[model samples]
Target: MDVSYLLILLLVGAFATYFSGDKLASKVALVFALASLGMSVYILNLFNAGQNIDFLSAWITQPKVAFALKGDGLSLAMVLLTSALIPIIIYSSFGNEYKNAKSFYALILFMAFAMTGTFLAADGLLYYIFWELALIPIYFITLIWGNGDAEDRKKAVVKFFIYTFAGSLFMLVAFIYMYQRSKSFLIEDLYAMRLTVKEQTWIFGAFFLAYAIKIPLIPFHTWQAKVYQKAPAVGTMLLSGIMLKMGLYSVIRWQLPIGRFAAIEHKNIFIGLGIAGVIYGSIVALRQNDLKKLLAYSSLAHVGLIAAGAYTLTLDGLRGAVLQMIAHGFVVVGLFLIADIIYRRYQTRTIGEMGGIRQQAPKFTSLFMILVLASVALPSTFNFVGEFTVLFSLSQINMGYAILGGTTIILGAYYMLKMFQQVMLGETNKKAFADVTFNEGFSLVAIVAVLFFFGLYPKPIVDLITPSIEHILTFINRTN
Candidate 1:
């Protein structure tokens, strides 16, 4: 089967959903999202069976770009993450009504299409195109469906748009420079080219600017909290759950490999930056009153650790980063949905206003508690497996790095537990908060099931991603 079929399926789904009329649009979108997920699982099986599933054809002969879609274990793993989350995100939104619902639902699928393309594209230009394409749908989604003041929403979304677009231009320039050196834009061609220290430094810096902003590491994270707070629950989920992984994934797949020498030269500084985000994000998350913003900062901290692990350039580091990325995707989506659930009942996101929900809804509280525990990397949860491996990888570099990174778990637990206490415990609010409905319960169950199942036996994920990590590590350590 052609890998491009996945992209085609979503694109067609988006158009079909947009025309499906508002009442049926969401359901249509869900069907397509589920179909995309199924297709991804099938493709993954084919890949595991050792069948070739990549698609490559000429697109622009002059610049040497190709319309190419390639899948390996790593990319397919990310694809599966994107596919799996889109359906859940869509399903999670069922309780909320939106104006012009068809457009909103269609944008969700379109964003998925673009994100999946980013994971699968084999050419640098193609990857960059998909990377940028993913931005458009979300921009509209947030602006149109977002919760905050129109002006505030506009400011946050525009800042995100400009920051990301500006950073991407740097990446585009880097790719252009690489194409000049190699005469091709295919990832293999770029990966194979030998460049001077000066050239590698420039390339890595360009990619760093792009990925850092998207991942929103400490200094580049100014736009994140506001956007998350303002956007609708589903928009926040897409951004936190699957969008940020694009940056971390690019680091392992493109940045470290293509700019091995530069990454080695600047590993400490970047590693410090990642660890800094972890501590800083955790501290700031502790202070946030808005639930989504708190979750946004929490995501920053987790991805920070993931980025640090990738920079460690060891198999364990990269492998753990991928594992945590998948785990975080599911867990964070559940967290945001929990926030949405609260909002649906109390019509408020302020943590202080959300006390005593446990008195009202046991099932919702139980699921929320599981997510909170998973978020803190409780030993039996999926996050623990990833977090422990990431911290261990950092230890190989320096004990201090591991110690600093480990603060995420301690601080994550503290703030998450504190938030839970304030929000779910304390005086039972006079207002009655509804328990999780069937759809909400189903979504939470699916996420919790994945976390626990993988937490106990991560071997399947480990086996799937190890070879690919080893392959990428070759490029990362090629010159070292």
Candidate 2:
């Protein structure tokens, strides 16, 4: 099957949604997302049938650049994630009425195109194009539809745009330097280049700086909380659920092999930074009253652990990191949706303003509880599997690092339970709040089912990712 057909379908969906009226626009978007999901599953089937689905060819003659799209286990996993989440996001917007539903849906479909592109593109220049392209729709989505003070939204959007683009510049420089050295813009060629330790370290630093900022680790994370708090729920879902993974994915795809020695040599620094971000984010989350801000900081903490796992360079660590990336994406999106539910009912995100929701919305409470448990890495949850694997792998590297890194679990529980208790378990205030509507319930239930399903049996994902992880490790070991 020609995978380019999938891209064509997405573009067609974008145009169709753009022309449809408000009443029908959402339906068009939903259909598009569902079709995209079907296409993704078909791609998986093709892969299972032992066909290499990625398409690559010459693009620009003068620069000798190629347009390459490859789907290894990692890229396929991300593609599946993007495909799955878009429908949920589109569905979650059911209660939200936009002035121009056509434009709104079109933007969302366009964003989907960019995300799929980011995951599939294998050439450095092509990857960079998708990298920047992915940000455009989100910037507009947030700027046009975000809540809070207009100035606040503008400030947040500008900050997010500038921060991410600035990081991309470093990535661009790294890619150009690699192309200059190797005389090719192909990803595989860059990976194949022989470089001195110093060169590797410099390139690694450049790449790491870009990805870290995008992942927004520690000091670089200042923009995330504000942005999440200000952006609309759909925008928040897209950014936290899908876009952040670009950074983590890039780290695995671009930085590891290119900077294998740097990764090993500076493993301690990355690990230390990861630990700090995890602990710091957790502590900061404990103090946050705004629901969105709390979740934002929680995301920072979770990504930190994943980052540390990536730096470990151990098989289990890398596996756990990739799994955690997937798990976190789902869990965070669910959590944010829960936040959106509360905001819809009570019109406030402040924990102090929420109480006794369990009495009115047991279903919401139950789903929120599961997501919280997952966030805290409870047993039988996917988060537990990922966190345990990462910790176990960290132990292989250093007992002390494992011990320090493991505190995220404890800190995670403190903030998560605190948030849950405040929002769901308290005495009902005099105000009446509506229980979740069917559409809302469907979205939550779907996400909960996925979380539990994956949690109980993660072997499929683990099995799928193992070969790719092994392939990446082989490169690292060979280069070292």
Candidate 3:
């Protein structure tokens, strides 16, 4: 039940799939991802049985950082989320053809490997190492395999690489500063340190700079839409689905507690910025004609609220952020997949060119409609639960913030329905509009099934992460 088992399975599977040869790569990758999900379910069961799963070994003794990975309720939830979704991501790609199928699927597994590490790392240096490790595979994945013009994709990819890497440097400086005081990179040791207000402010600034750029609060979000547009469906899914959560997770686990008073002091400022992103992202999304770019902006809007909820630091806000993060991950994957589906069938992503897809494909229309509704936070969907909780929490802080955040409901509905009306419900097009195939339909159905399942009864995940949320709140509330 050690958490390392999950990492081992993923890393080994990456290599195995690579060597399995192109003929067998897709099947091998699918089997590996499914096997990993099966193991993860077992781990979740053990965790629910009130057992701890941890692995530790001496690593970099001079620096006093152990190869430490810990699994508590929070980390386990994220790891579970990553594990559960990888199979779906892999399966969704079954209809597509990648030039270098072996290396492509292998990168997907590698990205999951690094993300799992980031979630489980109990030490700051170790966490940062894993954090940086993640950006590598994704860089290559997008740069080489991305769509659009090669020069345009290269520019977009490089800007993202430089932006995020530069942000990490600030985080490393903060870690080294913390290291100077504690002589260790263990999270607990860093959390236990007593720093002057001046020092806390500096650390907070550095950490916030790093995480904001990733969670991509307003000014820092410049790279998102472009990068998302260029990357292939698989690449886009990896970025939106699980990679973005790394920043939000770090915000709750590392940023808030590490800079408690600073976070509290400037919280409203950051929260305002988050709400602004919600508005800005939504408004911009309204103007986008390209299907993927529209979803990209919509994602920015959705995560904007999630980020605001995290900054609120209320129980409702934090819990809602967690729930919404999971919900949004599933919903966005389905949305992007639908976009790809359209592009594959119609050979165009321009919404203006798409019409009456429902006439040709009722199932695709139904599934697409559900995901769009979920994105807009319609009632009876999992997104509604998270959006309600987050807005309620923000309202408690400032009604103005709630009102601003609430615009997502309106604007999201406007753009999503508008997109749908134009694309799925209109005059029948002369061009053929094919329905989703078995694999594609299965992927979308699986996603919608989870959304409704948790949408109706989220108590399992809600109960599972409650203790961890309490643990997080304790550090944030500490006066020391």
Which scores better on lDDT, 2 or 3?
A: 3
- lDDT per residue for candidate 1 within 1-480, as digits (tens), equals 978999999999999999999999999999999999999999999998999999999999898889988899899999999999999999999999999999999999999999999999999999999999999999999999999699999999999999999999999999998988899999988888989888999999999999999997879999999999989999999999999999999999999999999999889998999999999999999999888888999999999999999999888899999999999999999999999999999999988887988988999999999999999999989999999999999999999999999999999999999999999999988799889999999999999999999999999889989998898888777853
Clashes of 2: 0
| Candidate 3 structure, TM-score to reference | 0.99
Q: How would you encode candidate 3's per-residue C-alpha lDDT over 174-202 as one tens digit per residue? A: 99989989998888888788988889889
Tens-place lDDT digits, model 2, residues 1-480 = 645667777889999999887789999999999999999999888987889787878899867788888887888888888889999999988978887778888989998888888888888989899899889999988999898999989999999999889988988998888888898988788888898899889899988878888887987888899999999999999999999999888888889988888888898999889888899999999999999999999999999999999989888988999899888988999899999988888889999989998998777778889899999999888888899999998899899888888889999998899889898887995678778889888998888788778889998889878888898888788933
Alpha-carbon error at 132 in model 2, in Å? 0.2
lDDT against the true structure, per candidate, is 0.94, 0.88, 0.91
- Cα deviation of 444 in candidate 3 (Å)? 0.2
Clashes of each: 0, 0, 0
Q: TM-score of each candidate?
A: 0.99, 0.98, 0.99
